[model samples]
Target chain A: MSLVLRETALAFRRAPLLSALSVTTIAFSLFVFGLFGLVAVNIQRAIGNVAERVEVVAYLKRGTPLQAVALAAADIEAFPEVESVQHVTEQEALARARRDLREFQDIFQDLETNPLPASLDVRLRPAFRDVQRAAAVAERLAALAIVDDVRYGREWVEKLDRLRNIAGAVGTVVGAAFALVAIIIIGTTIRMAVLHRSREIAIMRLVGATDGFIRRPFLLEGILKGLLGGVLAVGLSYGGYALIDAYLLRASFFTAAQATLGVAAGGFIGLVGSLVSVGRHLRST
Target chain B: MIKFTGVTKEYLKTGAALKQVSFHIARGQFAFLTGHSGAGKTTALRLIYLAERPTAGEVRVSGFSTARAGPREIPRLRRRLGIVFQDFQLLEDRTAEENVAFALEVTGARHTTIRPRVMRVLTQVGLAGKANQYPRELSGGEQQRVAIARARVNDPVVLLADEPTGNLDERATRGIFQLLKDINASGTAVLMATHDLDLVRSMDAHLIELQQGEVVYDSAEDAAGRQPVAP
Candidate 1:
């Protein structure tokens, strides 16, 4: 262990510029990855919120009895996909219209009788938030005897769902690509370090040093670089998140668990990279 | 002790580097391997340290058959032997003391044991006061001494030197030869490979001469008035 430490210290001392460059490259790569993660998390959260608000509005027929309207609502609520049903009376619908369009309030006041039909607002469970599923539920509601028509923003919901899928796919692909690049960068850096100390390694081998003994110091160096890079990335991400949160009055995009996971991933990448580079060199020698 | 029996080394690119060469050095014995360039002198030493396996036959160093030693066993076998190079392959950035200590360090020696042993070897090589000097700062002879110190630091049962004086002046060569002789006096068997006939004749040590991967002459056998067939 002391030998590993000494060798690592000597390596850094021998090539400070190279070590710094490696660490910087790793930090920048991890920072970009973390930034993408933050964006993906925020986008997913926004999509979830939008999907939760999707509901089917079922209008009641004119002169429908109050008891019939309540029965229709109860039947809609019994659907497996339905989460809840809210009854909107004609008077309440008129009042909502008045609140939504105050400038058109004069037109509603001039009406002799309430022409607005009562409606049943049907909210589906989160699993049934797809455009096709909601449309199917709306069709079932529209068949009710007391229901006149059923409407849900199928086109808009489909578009939003597509957008969410695209975001998720792009996030995964780009994140994986970034991680692969980070591993390559780290492996190349460690390879350079090993090359720089090739003579030392040969001498060690001559003196009965096992492959593990010769490789430990370099592995430690790679891990240390990875750990520092992770810390830098985490710090930058946290600071950026704090800045965004402060300016936009929004909650953090990355959870504590995600931050920890990111750091762990960085360390793991460094270890794998080191192992690959060192193993190749050892095999060749 | 080191022994090679009908050892042959074949390289795909260059063919045989050593061919059916056989010899033996008893415990605490000192011998010289002398030959022209590409005469298998270095290859013979390499086989002793398990650097090259015999394409045929066997090599035994300190009672371990190098040809049969597994990967995990090779390092342990090497720990019982020390090797010196023609270029005096010292770590240029490290102090002489550190270079010597590195040998022990690789063997997982304790810190307290390593320090005194490193100092003792440096002193043995007459570099006690220059322990802290880097290879670049030291003279050619001092650097060579550092290499020797590193090799001797572990008190290996056998010391293999390949052209140890190839880059040294007459003064440095004599000093290094004397050091090797003194090291041998301390009971470590030494196998030194060189083409310096004058030094070999001067010392009159046991000589094994190779020619085109074949052993042409062995002094010990010659002293017994026996001639072995050369392949």
Candidate 2:
């Protein structure tokens, strides 16, 4: 173990330029991947905010009893997907309309009787905010005897669902492509490091060093380089995020857990890349 | 002890490197493997070290046979034998002492014993005073001495030298040959491969000469009147 550490340190000292080059290469590659991840996370969040507006509104018939309406509101709130059901009285609806649509406030004030209908506003749970779930809840609300009509933005909800699916598919496919590129580029970089030490490896073998012994130092070097690269990559990604968030529209960065996962992913990639690169060199020699 | 019985090595591109060759070296015996560059001297040494397995037949060295030596067994076998090359395969980044200590380290020798063992071999190779010098700072002969010290540090039963003096001038060559002789006097067997026929004539060591991958002469068989050679 001490020998392995000594050898790894010696290798870095022996070829600092090569080591730095490989680390920089890994960092840039991971930075690109991290940038894409940042974009995906922000897109998902934006879609989530939009999905919060997907609620079903059920307008009651004019003569519906307050007791019946109250009972119906309690039943709807009991549904598994229903987050909350608020009942707005006719006067409250008129007041809300006057507030929301100020251009029509004059006409609302001139009216002798309230022209608005009392309604139940149904907000679904986050997970149930998609088009199919909203439509299903609307169908149930329309079945109530007191509900004259129910509206849930069917076309708009369907369009949002399509956009969400497209974003998800693109995120997965593009993320995978970036990850593969990082592996190949990082693998080649590690291979160069192995090749640089080919003479030392051959001599180690001649001196009766086991294959496992020869591989340990290189593996440690790779992991260290990867870890450094990962940290640098995170720093670079943050710099990029800061630029965009400051100059452009508001954006979100990775959560702490997600950043840690990105760094761990870098280490994992480094380990795998070193394994393959050193394995080939050992096999060939 | 080392023995080769009908050992044949075939490469896909270069074809047969050794052809049905057979020989044996008793414990603590010195021998010479003489041949032209195209002959199988290096190939024979490689077989002994398990660098290349025989296409046919067997190579048995230090209780490990190539036929049965798995990946795990190869290192064990190699630890019992030391290998030297014409290029003096010392790590340029390491000092002479570190180079020698590397062998003992690989064998997982006691940490307390490593410094003494390395110093002993460096002294044996006449490089004790130069222990801290890097290979690049040392002359060709001194570099080769570091390589030999590294080879000898493990207390191997047999030392295989493939043109150990090939890169040295005549003076250095003679000095290295004498070093090997001194090492052999310490009871370790030596198998030296060389194209230097004059060096072979200077010694009464056991001789096995090869021509184009086949053994053309064996001094032991000739002395025993079992096989006759043209010259």
Candidate 3:
């Protein structure tokens, strides 16, 4: 193992320029992938923020007692998908309309009796905030004795679902494409490194070195380069994130685990690239 | 010991390199393979080292036969023998000592033993003082000596030299030839391929001459017909 390390060091020392070039190339490739990942994460967060507003409002009958509505709220909150249920009095509903819909102030001010009905505002959990789940919960709420009608903006919820699905699908496909490009570029850079040392490899084989022995140093070099490149890529991605956050809209950087995964992906790509390049060199010569 | 029986090597592009060539070298013998540029001398040496297999017949070296040796066994067989080329195939980036140590290192020799063994062979080739010098810093003759030191570091049973002195001047050629002679005197058989007829005539060594890929003359087989010989 020490010998392997020594050989790896020797290779780097022998061609520092080429080694640096390889690492830089790998870093940039992974950087592109990292940029896409950042975009995907931010898009997903935006969709999630929008989904949080998804709630079903069940309007109560005018003659329903407040005591009965409180009991219904308790039962509705017990549902697995229900995050929370709030009972809004008819007066509170009128006040909300006055605060939220300022453009309809003239009509609301002229009203003698409160036209709004008391309602149960049912907010679903984030996981159950899709069109289908919201509709299912609305159906259940409307079946209650006191619930005269239910309104959760069916078309709006469906549009949000469509937007979420498109974002997820596009994220996956683009992410995969970027990752594949990064791998191919990294593999090519490592191949150039292997070819740079072709003479040394030929000498090793001539001196009776086994294929495993010949591959060890190159493998180590590849992994090390990959790891370094990965860290560099993460750094580059962070720089990009900072620039975007400062100049454009505020954006979320990768979580700690995601950043670590990015580094590991770099190392993994390096290993695979070195394996292929060295394997080809060994087989051909 | 090295022996070839009816060895024929055919390439797809160039056709046959060696055509039914046969020769034998006993243990501890110093032999010269003399031929013109395209006379299959390198191919014959390559066969002895297992770099290329003979299309027909067999190459038996130190109990390993080309017909029977598996892929896994090739490195093991190579470890028992030393191979030298005219270009002095040393890693240019490494020092002479490092180049010599590479051979021992490949065989997984003890790390502690490598330095001493490398020094011994470098001293044997009279490059003990220049062990730290890289190949580019050394002359043609000195670089070849480094290569010889690397070859001899393994204490191989046989040394196969494919035009070891082809790139050297007359003085360096004499020096390398004397070095090989000294190595041969220490009981390691040397089979050298060279087109230098003058070098072939310089000493009383076994000679094999190839012409158009056929062995026209072999000192050991003046009377024996082209038949397989059991070692």
Candidate 4:
């Protein structure tokens, strides 16, 4: 353990510039990945909020008995996908229309009979709030004997779902590409380090040092680089997030758990990249 | 102890570097491998150290057959032998003591054991006062001494020197040779490869001369015992 630490310290002392360059490259790459993660998280939260409010409105036929309407409402309420169902009478519907059209309330007073149909407002469970499932539920309601029409904003919900899917796919592809670049950057840095210390390696081999002995210091060097880079990336990402929140009122987009995961992933990539580079060079020599 | 029986090494780029060469050095025995450049003297030493394998025959070092040793076993085999080169190969940024400590560090020796052992070897090589000096600050002879101290730090059974005096002045060469002789006197077998015929003759040690890739002479059997064979 002391040997590893000493060698790692020596390596850093030997090439401070190169070490810093590697760490900075890793930090920037992880920062980009963290930014994408933040955006994706916010997009998902927004989509979920929109989906929660999705409800199917079923209009009853004119002159339908209240008892039949109540029976249909009870049947809809029994569905696994249904969260809650509210029955609105004709008078209540007319009153709601009057409240919504307050600027023209005098026109509603001239009508002797109420023109608004009674309806059932059906709220769906969160899991069944997707466009396809909600549309399926609305179709089943329309087939009921008392229901005259069903509406669930099918077009708008579909558009929102498509947007969410596209965002997720884009985030994944971009994140993977950035991760690949980080690995390549770290690999190149470690390869340069191996080349720089070729003489030391040759001497180590000459003095009966095993492959593991020679590789330990370099492996430790890579781990240190990755750890430092991870810390830097986390700091930069959190600082950037705070700035965004202060300026645009978008605070709390990235959670602490997500930042931890991102840093851990970055550190792991750095370690793997360093190992591959060192292993390749050692094998070739 | 080292033995090479009908050893042949063929490189793709250079063809056969050594052809059917055979030799042996018993425990506590010292010998010189004398030849011109490309005469396979270094190749012979490398075989013993497991740096290169015999293409056609066997090489046994410290009772382990290098030909059959796996990658994991090679280092274990190497630990029984020490190697020195023409270039000092010392880490320029490190102090002389640290360079010597490297050998012990690779073997996972304890820190308390490493410092005393390193200082003892440095003092043995007559560089005790220069232990804290870097390679760049040390003279050529001092740097080479540090390299020798590093090789001796592990107390290997067989010390292989590949042109150890190639880059030294005559005075420094004499000092280095005397140091190697002192090391040999301590029961560590030494196999030194060099083309300095005059030096080889003056030492009165066993000499195995190589021409091309074949053994041309073996002083152990006297010059009249073996004729020069072409590869």
Prediction 2 TM-score vs. true:
0.96
lDDT to native, each model: 0.87, 0.92, 0.92, 0.85
Candidate 3 structure quality by residue, lDDT tens digits, A135-252: 9999999899999999999999999999998998999899999999999998999999888888888888888899999999988898899999999999999999999999999999
Tens-place lDDT per residue, model 1, A84-185, is: 999999999999998899999999989899989989989999989988899899989888888899899889889988998899889889889987887887
Estimate, for each residue in A221-255, the C-alpha lDDT of model 2 and write its tens digit. Answer: 99999998999999999999999999997999999
What TM-score, computed on C-alpha atoms, does each candidate reach?
A: 0.88, 0.96, 0.95, 0.89
Better of 2 and 3 by DockQ: 2
What class would a CAPRI assessor give candidate 3's docking? high
How would the candidate models be sorted by TM-score, starting from the highest?
2, 3, 4, 1
In DockQ, how does model 4 score against the reference complex?
0.68
Candidate 3: stretches off by over 4 Å: B223-231
User: In order, what fnat does every candidate score?
Assistant: 0.77, 0.83, 0.80, 0.71
Model 1 segments more than 4 A misplaced: A58-87, A101-106, A120-128, A132-150, A234-253, B223-231
Which ten contiguous residues of candidate 3 chain B have the minimum total lDDT? B222-231
True contacts kept of 3: 0.80
Instruction: State which candidate, 1 or 4, has the greater DockQ.
Output: 1
TM-score of chain A of 1: 0.82
